[model samples]
Target: MPHLTCTEACGPDELQRLLRPRSDVVVEEPDHSTPEDAPPDAPAPEAAFRAVDGPFHHYRRTVHVLERHDEECLVRQRISYRLSVPVWGWFITPLANRELRRPRHDGTQPFWAPAERLDPRAGQVLGVLCLLSVVAGYLGTLLSQTITFAFDEFDAGLATQGNTLAAVRVGVLIALALVVLADRRGRR
Candidate 1:
């Protein structure tokens, strides 16, 4: 299995066409974009995982083996490049050693395959329960303070107690918003 890295101009279909004729040719897609292929006009292979944080695009490109021999397999090799467009071409290979290092696949399944049923409501319920717990905790704290503290002291502590409750409410609001957004996206 010969691992070959081609330019971004080479599409998967084109690469497959190039390798399909040959029995031993193995093609591995690159992980990142290059200088010549920066403009987004060039054809880039679809990646499995993608994330955008700050100014940089963080992601991993997964190239599944289309064809392989019994003993050897094809793997995609990607070179990460930071694109400033039409300017400097900075090649960034942050985790070269770690990226190259792959775990050995023994090709055997574990004894117990515990399948999980994902209830859609479970996550939302958990988030709501957590929010309720936080609110309950704040209420409990306030109730405890009322039992021990003088009336004037309790009045002074009310603002501080309210702040804590507000923080929890804000957190719950964010969680609920996230859940609602996720639910909408899932429906789409």
Candidate 2:
């Protein structure tokens, strides 16, 4: 693919537009660990971020060389996805899972979750699930806080936004009920 040239300096805003030009794609928790004490022979600055868009959710590591070759910078992106198997990827890729689950930088791993590994204790699973639900609810609230713009786009009146959210709640209920039923009934 051809590289993009920005007229102004390449800042975070410019990188946001250049790297991901999609409205639906949201890159979260970007880590730009550029070492200041590194020597001149050190490698270019690398950036790692979690991109969650549509059906594709993965972590990407991009190396953007600051050097100019013909006044153009070269960017190389590498993606490491934990799930790569055909039907059930989580069960297939044991080595990749191990690498992902391994402890990294100060007991903190970026965008990594121990999803497949579950404690057999029912109470423990319930506690974890409850915490997850709380986190998910907080995120949902954050999304709803900014949803006024979307509501206005649909010619939202006083009740429009409320009604829309109520509809979403109902949809979520139905969807979750279906999910519970699907596991019991078996869906292809």
Candidate 3:
């Protein structure tokens, strides 16, 4: 998964006004516990919202107003979700599960880049390549296990092929890393 964050400045009143127009977002009950590691003087989250219905619901986006002091406020955004299919949810969900966060930041004016800016076509292509690499790696492992089970001995030929597959997997992963790095750099 890729990590992304950006900051914006806005007044607390303005932030609430902005959220008021979003029909899909519903305010959540406030959490009472303060983080142990947080400063003793740190303000508690003033409000929260859940995306119960919208395009964002697929991503399970949650918004938290972490603090509001004077005219400044901080907002925290989190998204975590897995695509589910009826009965065997656990088995299939892992493949598409995603968890990401945009941590709270205090500001006086709102600023946000389009989410699409963080996920361009190049990133999607890299993700597909990564998924293919995983499948290929799994198949290679299965093949090696089957050969060993049948022969009662490790097959050096199959081992060689597995090593080649491993190399290819590493190469694909490296390419994916480079693509993500380039994308991040381009955004900056």
Q: Residue 140 of candidate 2: its Cα lDDT?
A: 79
Per-candidate Cα lDDT values, in order, are 0.39, 0.47, 0.45
lDDT of 1 by residue, 1-188 (tens): 11224333345554454332111111123335444435767444444222231112232333444345555445453423222111111221222223222311332222221122112243235446656778878976776566435546656565776676578678769988998999899889
lDDT, model 3, position 19: 45
Residue 135, model 2: lDDT of: 88
True-structure Cα RMSD, model 1 = 14.0
lDDT of 2 by residue, 1-188 (tens): 11222123344544444354222212235556543444779666455555432122233434453544544544444334433223334333454334333323233323433432322242244445666778888977876987798777877786977887898799789989997998788754
Error of 2 at 50 (Å): 33
* Whole-model alpha-carbon lDDT for candidate 3: 0.45
Q: Candidate 3's residue-wise lDDT over 20-96, tens digit each?
A: 32331122223344434457875543433333322221333334566667888776644343322233334433322
TM-score of each: 0.26, 0.28, 0.27
Clashing residue pairs, candidate 3? 9-108, 9-109, 10-107, 10-108, 10-109
Q: For candidate 1, give the lDDT of residue 85.
A: 15
lDDT of 1 at 51: 22
